[model samples]
Target: MIELKSAGEISAMREAGRVVAGVHAAVRAQAAVGVSLRELDQVARTVIHEGGAGSSFLGYHPSFGATPYPGVICTSVNGVMLHGLPTPYRLRDGDLLSVDCAVHVDGWHADGTVSFVVGAARAEDLDLIRVADATLAAGIAAAVPGARMGDVGHAMSAVGRGAGYGMQNDFGGHGIGREMHESPFVPNEGRKGRGLWLRPGLVIAIEPSLIAGGGDDYHMASDGWSVCTGDGSRSAHVEHTVAITQDGPVILTVP
Candidate 1:
């Protein structure tokens, strides 16, 4: 069921969002050439713990997951789209990396993702990341009180399509609060003026994932978690947890 958060609950979520943001900042700083994905995950774990929050990703066994997740953060490198397991794979210069992290504080949850190049970023990779950031911004802007969920998706997909990027509709954003995942699945693409109507206290994660090759097809990795582009093209993912409020849409997952 769709659960609207109270003002106090939203405040608690904001605190959790701050912890998630800290993890992103620390992971981004530690992500460099020669750094292993596991190292990055450890960085996130440390930050989450120091912030007095618990990881929502660690031990999380979603319905599709084969086992409980072992990492505090997801480190998707290059063509890997999402749910990339943190292994012993070391980073190399020019590698594109996307880090996804979620945390809970006082029972409220927040989730977000960031994509960037490790070192010596390629022009094309930078462009893809830019589009992903723009797409996320558009989606967050559309998430205002009185707007429909489709409006947010439409706003996000429009930016991706206009950039000639492909979107993965199979996996998208969703409501987040007491639990890391909640009701009202938020698609990356949708028609305007359709889907759930936005209202005050409604909080959801707005993530926009774009494939550079302009194809949506993807395949699962042998590890049973990592998702990669079928065409072997690079991808970028960016996200922010937003709350529809009486005044406007407020982004909860911000540093």
Candidate 2:
């Protein structure tokens, strides 16, 4: 069921959102060439610990997961779209990195993601990242009251298709609350004027992940966690936790 948060609940959620945003900011600044994904996870752990927040990803074992997720952050690089488990692999030049983090404060949860190039930025890499970012923003813009969930998906599709990029609907955003991955799945491509109606206090994660190639096919890595493009092309992902309100969409996980 889609639970509409109360005013008090929204306040608590904002606290969680603040921590999530701070963690993303810290990770973005600390990301650089030669840094290990494990090291980046440590940075996120420190931020969550210092802020007295709990990790929403750590120890999380979803139905699709093989084991309990052991990291506080997800470090998806290049072809990996999402759920790239942290490892000892170090970053290299021209690597497009996607960092996803979530935090819980006083029982409320917030999630966010950021994708950027580590050292040297390729023109195509920059374009992919930029388009993903803009696509996420457009998705958020569709979260206003009275808007259907399909409208959000439509906006996301327009951004990706307009850029000549294929949509990866295998994984997308979802409603989030006391637990992560709540009701009302949000896809990256869909028709408008369909699905659930948006209302005040409905919070959802609007994540737009895309590959620069021309197909939506993807493959799973041997690690049983990371997912990569089937064509081996680079991928980018951007996300923000947004809330529908009487005033419109409010970005809760802003950095």
lDDT of 1 by residue, 101-138 (tens): 99999889999999999989999999999999999999
How do the residues 91-187 of candidate 2 rate in per-residue lDDT, one tens digit apiece? 9998999999999998889999989899889999998888888898889888889989999999999988899987788698999989878987988
Estimate the overall C-alpha local distance difference test score of candidate 2: 0.89
TM-score between candidate 2 and the true structure: 0.98
The residue-level lDDT of candidate 2 at 72 comes to 95
Candidate 1 lDDT (Cα, whole model)? 0.92
User: Which candidate number maximizes lDDT?
Assistant: 1
Clashing pairs in 1: none
Which regions in candidate 1 have their CA more than 4 angstroms from the true location? none
Q: For every model shown, what is its TM-score relative to the native structure?
A: 0.99, 0.98
Minimum summed lDDT over a 10-residue window in model 1 is located at 58-67
Error of 2 at 108 (Å): 0.4
